[model samples]
Target: MTQAMSCNEAAGLVRSQGAVVLHTSPTTYDRYVSGPGMCLLDQTTEPAWVRTADSTQCFVGYRCRAIELEIGQ
Candidate 1:
């Protein structure tokens, strides 16, 4: 987060910090987190999106927040 890193680095960080990463298109991003263990890190404002490098119709959201992944009891 404080420095540049690859996807693997980010994934490792997520695993270390007990989190889950969800990649989705504009239509599916918000809807995909409905299940338990998934929470929007910040709900006070609308999430932001960053376009993919290929210029494809895909983007990453919630990158700046701490999304928590909980486990089922």
Candidate 2:
């Protein structure tokens, strides 16, 4: 049986699910120069699990891969 989890709790769940996880900080910021002023973007990279299913919930033995984003142009 699989356990219900929140977005934050899904980090450990993803690992236990035999998925490749990419963990990051809570306050991930990206600063870039857009024309004149600088643009500051804030996001969360704690842990996002992507599985092979369309449903929101996944089984315990499910597989997931954490997504990575590249900053800068």
Candidate 3:
């Protein structure tokens, strides 16, 4: 089952495995090409984990289950 995790946790997971999508801009979210999870750039924002040494864009953590599923777990 999908779990409620901090953005920090999600960043780690995405960094290692990859996410279905990496939300950058709200309007651009749907436009992102569906492919391998985005590389978590060092966005200087919150959660601290996603922050890297290059990028300043930050993805604040989510409070809800960030992932959506089609099958029952």
Global lDDT scores for all candidate models: 0.36, 0.31, 0.34
Q: List, residue by residue over 40-69, the lDDT tens digit for candidate 3.
A: 333122232233233343353322223444
- Candidate RMSDs in Å, in order, are 11.4, 14.1, 14.8
Clashes of 3: 1
Q: What is the TM-score of each candidate against the true structure?
A: 0.27, 0.19, 0.25
RMSD of 1: 11.4
Candidate 1 has its poorest 10 consecutive residues by lDDT at 29-38
**Cα misplacement distance, residue 16 of candidate 3 (Å):** 0.6
lDDT of 2 by residue, 1-73 (tens): 1123444344444444433332222333111111111111332233222322233532222222234467873
User: Candidate 3: deviation at residue 51, Å?
Assistant: 16
For model 2, name the residue pairs that clash. none
lDDT digits (tens) for residues 1-73 of candidate 1: 2123344443344445543444343354332221224445443222333234333322222334344457972
User: Could you tell which candidate, 1 or 2, scores higher by TM-score?
Assistant: 1
